[model samples]
Target: MSTTTDTAPITIHIPTPLRAYTDEQATATVEAATVGAALRALVDHYPELDANLYTDDGTLRSFVNIYRGDEDIRHLDGPDTALEAGDELSIVPSIAGG
Candidate 1:
């Protein structure tokens, strides 16, 4: 059996809009193995972010975009994307149109 190694906490960048739920902090560090875990940590720590980040069905909100570094998580493995020790997750909210 293979063993899992504990890694350094990852940095999550909180956008201006969502900073309120994070106690006005622009960034947060969390120990997680995947993007989903990182996001869940945030939601768990700050329950207020739940409504904004997820839908009633517990899915990520359509207007909220998550990116690992410069790559969008949706193009990767969505929430299952693996994260590195120093990986940075950016949460971006989409703007609607015209």
Candidate 2:
């Protein structure tokens, strides 16, 4: 695999519930040219998380959301959006009840 030496690595904060899928790490660094690539990098590193993030159509799961620096992904070309250094990507799982 090639390394990203020129661009700063982006950080993806792993929520408590998803920590187990990432070997208990609270945060992980992923190297990618774009947000979609970063997500692919994440799943590559943690195969178990693939099911939680993607649907059969290869779209992000409806119950899951990806935020880029407080911006919702759906409004920013979804995962294909590019990401810069210091940008935050969060994966939020929807809660159910009532």
The 0-to-1 C-alpha lDDT of every candidate, in the order given, reads 0.90, 0.81
Residue-wise C-alpha lDDT for candidate 1, range 1-98, written one tens digit per residue? 22244445899999897888899999999998889999999899989999999999999989999999999999999998888789999998888988
Cα error, candidate 1, residue 82 (Å): 0.3
What is the per-residue lDDT of model 2 for residues 62-86, given as tens digits with 9 covering 90 to 100?
A: 7888888888888998766777777
- What's the lDDT of the predicted structure labeled candidate 2? 0.81
The best candidate by lDDT is 1
Residue pairs with colliding backbones in model 2 are none
Lowest summed lDDT across 10 adjacent residues in model 2 is found at: 1-10
Model 1, clash count?
Answer: 0
